[model samples]
Target: MEMVERYIYAVTQRLPQGQRIDIAEELRGLIEDMLEERNDGRPVENTDIERVLIELGSPAELAEEYRGTSRFLVGPDLFPAYLSVMKMVLIITVSAMGIIFAVETILTPMSILHHFVDLLISLFVTATQVFAWITAGFAAAQYFGVAPPGLSGGYNRKNWNPSELPPVPDKKKQIKRGDVLTGIIFSILLLVLVRFSNHLFGVLLFEDHHLEATIPFLNEEKLLELMPLIYLMVAIGIVKEISKLMAGRWTKNLAIANLVINGAIFLLAMFILRDQAILNPDFVQQLSDSWGISKQQEEYTTIKTVWKLSYNLALAAFVITLLIDTVTGFYKAFRK
Candidate 1:
């Protein structure tokens, strides 16, 4: 009876929301009828139930039968997840743009309608890109036979047995929705800032609360040359989040993939950061002049030394964070 319930859940959970209830009822009746016929005046055993379910086919296959002829780009198996991720990405993108719009409105003199129109255009363009990337990521996963937990998501083979069903993931080990949402938003926000406004990471000098000067941290020309590497890092981050979303829980393969992805990012960042030419050498000289320090003085030298070391500090900090995330992922995945 417990197996019976588990089998029913495995089937119905894969279906579209509107059809789940009715299909569950229909599948339940079908299973019962099959069991009765198999009973043959003898006591129905566990073997009897297993045989019946196996004959009825895998939950994924049964769910497909219930869905009937039509096919979907994401397919019914992944449509729910695809839809969920799509909504979050789109909402986060619009909200991020809206906040940027609000700030732009306050900082600069522009017609409200002008800003609003710009927001609309940016939203349309960004949303289209987001929608396409998300759809492609999910489709790629499905095409490659990677699936999330539960209904129609385990191993892909000609024979999918009831026993082969993946165990219900522990919540502690599961990929939390909060985490996935937060990761997606932050990743998108960070990408936007780096791609369009890297200059924002700099000192903004003010005079009597009125803006005066900006001392940019990075050499814009050098950064422009390195934009491809930066984009690569962001792209890797997006893929990592997508993998986490589809995995639905920690796993050995996921932990390893996480380590590899994080490691690649760290290496790429360090590669970029170690090239001190990418940093604005003018930053230290300009600040030193503001402090009234002469070029021949020890103070100026010390300031410059510390300025260069900042990149090293950033690289070290990133490595530590990477290790923490990777180790935590493995612990969660393998814990009893």
Candidate 2:
């Protein structure tokens, strides 16, 4: 009996607090009853107790049974209010994960696919955590008898059918004028910063030759020539922020559009660079010479090929990310 008590405690300890005591008490009574029935009129023994516990099955299984039925905010019931909240949370979490992956992919030499996979894993982890919290809250409410019957399980009311769920209110319609003014101000600031960054890089590279004098093949002037795209990126950012303040659906679409544009630019840049590298090995040789290095310093061909392949792979990843963003954005836009 004591051993059974210990086993039950070990198993139930993993469960939330609301039902732990009740479950433990019920299990204790069950084990005792089993032992008594097994022993009959004879004295209780270790073998009898073991048999009783075995008949009761594993402690883990028993704990699981006590967990009862699980429910999500969006189940067969399709409650509009609950589904709306869950959808919003999922969108926000996935978007944040995408942004994190994009920044990491841009700054690091990691493959785009690797970063994307990481993002998916991260989103899954976040979603699991959200689900766990919701389940725990529901369990606590049910155990304490605090939740109304309507919310405790799937909606069953004839008048409140899943197919007839009420339309979700557009919360963006409540935004005030101040929000628009703030967005405009941010847009202007972003544009100025992007333009200034391009000018600064241009001056440092072409006119001054400050940092470019130190590193070879890092053409700041060429990068500055790409500044129009950077400005476009700033405009996209402004649009995204404004859309988010106005409507979630619009925000998602804007984000996808921005990703598509950036991905396309990255792909074009990679293709041009790769073709140039292949067509003119002398270009690479010149870069080496400018850096006061010899081709024999390393396996020149192997190094150039590897670098080109890596660049191409990174570009491919951008395209894949853009595709994922577009699909997810579309899903969010129409899921309601």
Candidate 3:
């Protein structure tokens, strides 16, 4: 009878979620009827259950019959997660690239058409890459015998309890896969930009139908020196975001991980910010020149003071937001 429950679980889990309860009940009745007919109302043992299961056939074959088809590249267990991840990645990547394209178009109206074409090409390339990598990862995971818990062999319907199921996330409080994917993309972009900050964050001067990168905000030497810490923080963030995406909801363990990663990031940021010479002197000088304010002038002094204040404020805001997020994660995971 225990094996019968497991057999039902194995089959019904592969069926549509909406049909699972009904099919499970029906299967139980049918199995009992068969056992009753066989044992003539005697107490059914494990041998009887095994024989009934063997007659009913393997769970996979039975599931296929219920599903009405055998066509699949990825098994039912992994397909939902695969589709969700692909959709999330495409949405985030396309939206981010579209925003950048829009900004470029606005900055240079004469090349709007050219930029639009470039945007299309960029979108296609990015989408293709994301799709390929996500699919490959899931495929590899599946091939290696890693799978979602209920989809494989371990789940037993008899052991299933309502309390063990995760709370149905309130629409307002839910952590969406798209959000996690967006975070991953943002972190990846940060890693890329920081690793090549001299090229990506430079002051752009447009002249004679061309754009020239004049100087960058961060000192090259200081930026390179900070790369080790920065890379570690960003790598941690990427892994955390990926874990959240796979989990598809907040849990106590994930909340703890989030808190730890956020704390590490904040500490690394503070260490980097403590260095006064992190910003390039030439960048400040160029800014002062552009604003027609001499280094000795009160206006230049005021500008520098404002810049420092803004930087500190931004850092404070970043830390506050991270803390708020970590707390919110815990609340979501632990709330009644």
Could you tell me how far off, in angstroms, the CA of residue 210 lies in candidate 1 after the best superposition? 4.1
**Per-residue alpha-carbon lDDT of model 3 for 244-335, expressed as tens digits?**
76556777888898898888888888887676566776776777786688999998888778777866787788989898989998998888
Residue-wise lDDT of candidate 2 within 198-280, one digit each (tens)? 22212232324223422223344544566566556556645554555444333445556645655664565455444443223
Error of 2 at 180 (Å): 21
Clashing pairs in 2: none
- For model 2, where is the 10-residue window of minimal lDDT? 198-207
> In lDDT terms, how accurate is model 3?
0.77
For model 1 the local lDDT of residue 221 reads 85
lDDT of 2 at 136: 67
Cα lDDT of model 1 by residue, 139-211, tens digit: 8877775765442456445667788777797888999877877876777666655554433556766677754
* Candidate scoring better on TM-score of 2 and 3: 3
- In Å, residue 231's CA in model 2 sits off its true spot by 12
Clashing pairs in 1: none
Give, for candidate 1, the lowest lDDT window spanning 10 residues.
148-157
Residue 200 deviation, candidate 2, in Å?
4.3
Which 10-residue window of candidate 3 scores lowest in summed lDDT? 148-157
Q: Which candidate is the best by TM-score?
A: 1
Q: Pick the candidate with the highest lDDT.
A: 1
Taking every candidate in turn, the Cα RMSD to the unseen true structure, in Å, is 13.8, 16.0, 12.6
